[model samples]
Target: MESADETNTKLNGKSPSPVRSTRPKRSVRLTVKPKCFRCDKCKCEFSDQTNLDYHVSIHATDKPFHCETCQLLFSKRASLKAHVRTHSAAASAAKKKVFKCDNCGSKFTTSSHLKRHTRTHTGEKPFVCDVCGSKFTQNSHLKSHARKHTTDKLFACKNCPSKFSRGSDLKAHVRSHVVEKTLKCDSCDAKFSKKSHLVRHKRKHSGERPFHCDQCAAAFPENYMLKRHMRRHSGEKLFHCDICGSKFLEKLYLKRHMYTHSTEKPFHCDTCGSNFSQKIYLKSHMLVHNGEKRYQCEMCDSKFLRRQHLTIHIRKHTGERPHQCTICLSKFLTSSNLKTHLRTHTGEKPYHCDTCGSNFSENSTLKDHMRTHTGEKPFWCSICGSSFIKNSNLKSHMRKHTGEKPFHCNICASDFSQSSSLKKHMQTHLNKYQPL
Candidate 1:
């Protein structure tokens, strides 16, 4: 008879993924000190099979049990019993390190998560929805995929009429209805709702072009941007002009160009009675009417309606301002005015501000800002051309220009552009004596 210590052996075979090594393998041993039921060293206590059947099933190297969802193979029947919990939704409720991926930092308690993430690198799609020809790398993707085929919107917003396919989608959409834009950029003051959209915004600040087109040297930050840019080179005009019959790649370009063809101005200013065909033109016009840009410059304390416009305004504070004066060795404040001043030296822009008889750095800003003294808005709104000491002040008065801050300073009643300003203001108590 072999001693228990001498007979103690380690199985020498490849284990699947080595995750099983953390848990010692347990199997029914044939050797017995107690009397055997039918024969010696033969029967399993749990099963009735005593001879070849019991010996082949439990003591075998072959993995007879396997999972249908995730491609995980198991050797023992009892080990396969615990594997089924991974596919269950309830299993996701309590998360432990059930599985981890080596390629990416993402970790999940279920083996399925690691499997799904591996698909991102391999581009594998095991799950496919039958209703639509949509394929997904994971079963959970198939669930979200099926929702697109059906009119059954399970996720409905309590506050709004909006409906969505998934519960998480509805939860994100609800955040937009609030009076706040809490999503601040790490690089800048810009805020956005969706993280994907914020990522797109980040690329704008960083000037990152991740999406590349093989057809051309052109690249964009997003897939849709690349798709749109590719159309320009390919001349793939999907959006056709009704009047001229000329086609454009994008709907927005066609819409903006439609203004030349159509006399109908859809976008109208409530204050000035000015009308516009394009929605963006309407938004710009509405901004003109409202005279407001909520985004203020952190450097020199200037405000802009659009975040990009404010970004351009920010270049003013830094000496890196590209807009330079063409006259004798002079550099000026902002890009807009630099072009106008360049005209005086370069004599580039022949257009002059008539009231002051001053040649402008920019024909537009000078033209707009000049209305201050004349109190004359020749481009008066059909609604009302309100008076301001400056046209910029008139723009500031535009009722639509509301900042994120609803409250103002109690002492001066001065309005701040953002809520962060108020928070910083309140903190001034601790550092009141501190020098700048």
Candidate 2:
């Protein structure tokens, strides 16, 4: 079985193209926080004493609040109260339950939480956005949605001046600056911010995949990962784009697709000023400018910007072609390459030119075909300065420089750069062999 990481990585196959621009440079210096109280456990520093005390609690093995029956430790009394409720049903009933529903027997800790839950059974959308026709169960959700309509981003990051509409989003952004790896795995010394993250990371080593999909036999380490995989089987796309009315299984894909309708590329590379629709794409593009090929093949010294590319390149060394064409049984290194090869058997010409109704099997072929209509010869020979529509034509033209003949004639010691000239030369030998 393939790992959860491999499955998740393969799902995001669509790569965004970087927009090359030499615009005016803008320098945004990253905010550096002063290290005051440093923890002896992880050596992480905190800005305040209160924050330092909170950080120390994560590493603390002994807790003051302990259950008499289970002997399970909890730092907070409220957490102990919640944990005790899981074991004893009678103890849960004795607790101060503020929110009780009349429709259902469900009880909540707070009234706000119960109000949110009540909406599910009542089918009531009390909170509606004024800007959009979108309705929400809670007022908080409506307020979060309303931020998109207005330029009111109250939560600003101290690490950088980056602002977010939601406080939760701001907290997540702040984590990048303050939080390093707080929790460490016992199997491996690999660290994580949260204990839950450490638990997920340890799964990779222990091979403990507890979460199983009901639709398929696929298993994952995390429940959220299992949920993500189920979307493929269920065909349930919750996220919808307002602009195109197109639905996506994931919100990240929907955001990436939104770029197609817009002319703006907000995420720019500091090194090259190359713009990208997504921040992740910009980070990947920056590797090109920095010459940072971190993912290297073990067999060969060949390096790649992305781990996916490295994985594909490693297959070349192993001769392991996992992606196979269903029709022809031909195997390929990558799924994209397999998809292209499958088209040969399927006779699927999806790409079409608008100018001329000519269809092409590949998008690249259609792009090259457009050059004929526009008379655009982008590929130019460095030797002769002669231009051609295709790079292959320009490559053949380059042989005039050093007179490199790749194709040779058997009859005579004649060589040609162009394969057509070699074929025409072969005809002479064929004529000579023919009896009159």
Candidate 3:
């Protein structure tokens, strides 16, 4: 304490200073790294080089990140990872709980799905769009409807100039470019691009109509057909033709009606070298060449090439006149007959002959009238090779070859091949009974 340490402590009442390091101190070198990695497209900046490269990949047309579970592709790996999780979650949830709707007995994996399905029966539309004020049963459907208000088309066709707001619509449009139809019908030569279309086509051969309408006794092979049938009851013609301003119940009917505007026949028949405006018309024409009467009437020996013709022919035996006129209350066997009958009341002669300036209420009548200008006799007798303008004329001429006297007089009980001949014979009986 009385030494140099005590003298230094007594002077300031403190201890001596600590010794410092002799080696050079290292500087921290605080460098603020700027976002040097900038994207050429969109001009997005990122601190990390890997993140910038990922952001640039989004602008590329090709999607490198592939989901093995669903064959879905994404631009970013993170998005692919998230989509993979959804597949896993769906698989797991399917195995776990199965939520069912009490009203419709529809089974779904999640309670949310069951709730959304319950809205179909209850007619509950909880989600409403702010833009168009349209209501939807689910939030996802509302989101889809909201896209109609915006002009932003995110999805575009690579092969065409068509752009779609929805990815599903773009996917459906891409199917048009597919040249080959993978789904083939085992019963017929009909081929389809989609499995659903093939399944529906097979129903035509099997006569399996699973879908039924609640409002009527009508049944259809597909659910869409049942939905289309409901439009008849509603009297809703939503689909419109731009050329003729004609409205149709369905888009398919509108599409078929569009062919009337143009003389171009795109569909060709390979067998007869004939052309048709629609593919369905070509298909129906091919049945004539093949002589394939697949549909047969059980009530009579008469057979028809088409199922609809057989259905109408069966109604003749049943006397079931379902279609009725609202104005005159006249019942018709078929809808076409009713439509033609209505034209008689309205005096709507839509079909006109360009050559003769003659008008006809029915298109078939116009076609027959056009033959007068062209001097075309399509109907021919097989026995005598005699041609006629109308099918009725050919049918009447066929009785000469077959010796068929269908018309009989009640007075003389004499049979005549033609009705005109029977009328002339009835006059002969009347002349004999006259007082001389």
Candidate 4:
């Protein structure tokens, strides 16, 4: 080239082209890299150190970010932002116009909720389970019903062999094992896992029966108790015992009935080395050792270890005999008393002695009959050092020293120490009014 500028001018302002190279072009390839950063606790892999650090903060107890609306703490700002949306949604829901059901007069926030509620009155089940063929009112209910057929139980209890399909059921089961019963009754030495249970227990001490029955004058502390009382009026026995084929109004009654068939006593008393089939029975038995009478009668100086015993004792003063015999029209304070009275009419001696082959209507009478064979005199007098097989015999013998006449005759107005003596005294009046 003579001169680069002079050659461009002569060629009409055009430069000469460069020569082509015959070198092979190097091929460049792009590949995805494996995640190197991992968490020590949960073994979660992260692509970068920044993402791994954010995930690691979740395992820490310290929560730096907090929601301004509910004061709920969160580990990250993103979690706080997600929680703030719930408050915003709730605020929006509060401002929404309510939709009312004409049939039941039930109010709902949305038209969709009212439509779902209307199915209850119409007995309409739109959603059907594909596996079990069970119909449900809603899709969510059908999804829940579908879980019963599924073998996949995602949530499992860490402490026990119990596995649940739902995380909520697993959480509830976990509470049975590791429960912090912080809610305690101030009236008695009773602790509860929930505040609602503690509140219900407090009603017993306060004598506050807020839930009343519409059919009868009976009142209860809880709504469930009121429902159970209503079943007595309806004569509905929903729960049935598998072993004895006995039916009960409530599941609690059936559970207690099952204990009669069971030889295993799970609850043990440390004081007397006594065992009970139920924990509640063991709890009531513990009061005998501790001499703790928590329940007291308002009308009299009578104090009882159990609330039901106090309730029965109060009936003595008020004369509120709710349980009545249909045959004799005789009234009783408790259902158990009415049941025992019915046995007299039916001649059903359920309790039998294995040693003597003798039968008794009451279990306590059978227990006393067993004492005759064992020669066990449990009741003893403190003054005279006299022992008796039956506690009633010991009580009657004690009257000889103190001289207390409890049983009285309505005809002669004469009092006797024992009921048998009063019955014999009443025979004298029958002889006086003889038609000979």
Clashes of 4: 0
The digit string of per-residue lDDT tens for model 3 on 26-49 reads 988987778988776445678889
- Give Cα-based local distance difference scores for all models: 0.60, 0.73, 0.77, 0.77
* TM-score-better candidate, 2 vs 4: 4
Please give, for residues 1-436, the per-residue lDDT of candidate 2 as tens digits.
9887667667987444568888988999998778798876445678888889877775554567876444456776766898778657634543766677776555656787667666665657788888778876578768778888887676666568788776678767877786778788887778876555565677789998876664458888776687688666434455666654456778888988776544357997777555677887787787787767888888878989889989988888889999988887889998879877977987877666777788777666876787898898878777668999998888888888878999988778898988999999898889997999
Error of 4 at 34 (Å): 49
Cα deviation at 355, candidate 2, in Å, is 2.8
Taking all chains together, each candidate's TM-score versus the true structure is 0.26, 0.41, 0.49, 0.44
Instruction: Determine the C-alpha RMSD for candidate 1 after optimal superposition of all C-alphas.
Output: 25.7
Displacement of the residue 141 alpha carbon in candidate 2, Å: 22
Q: What stretches of model 4 exceed 4 Å from their correct place?
A: 1-245, 249-252, 261-275, 409-414, 426-436
Show where candidate 3 strays beyond 4 Å. Answer: 1-234, 242-245, 261-275, 423-436
Candidate 1 clash total?
15
The count of residue-pair clashes in candidate 2 stands at 0
Best by TM-score: 3
Instruction: Give me the overall lDDT of model 4.
Output: 0.77
Which is the winner by TM-score between candidate 3 and candidate 4?
A: 3
Give the per-residue lDDT digits (tens) of candidate 1, residues 110-228.
Answer: 67656655666565567878976655656765787687788767556666778777667876796777745667899988886434556678777888886666545877777678768
Which of the two candidates, 1 or 4, achieves a greater lDDT against the reference? Answer: 4
lDDT of 4 by residue, 275-341 (tens): 6889989987877988678898988787888888998898888889999999999999989899999
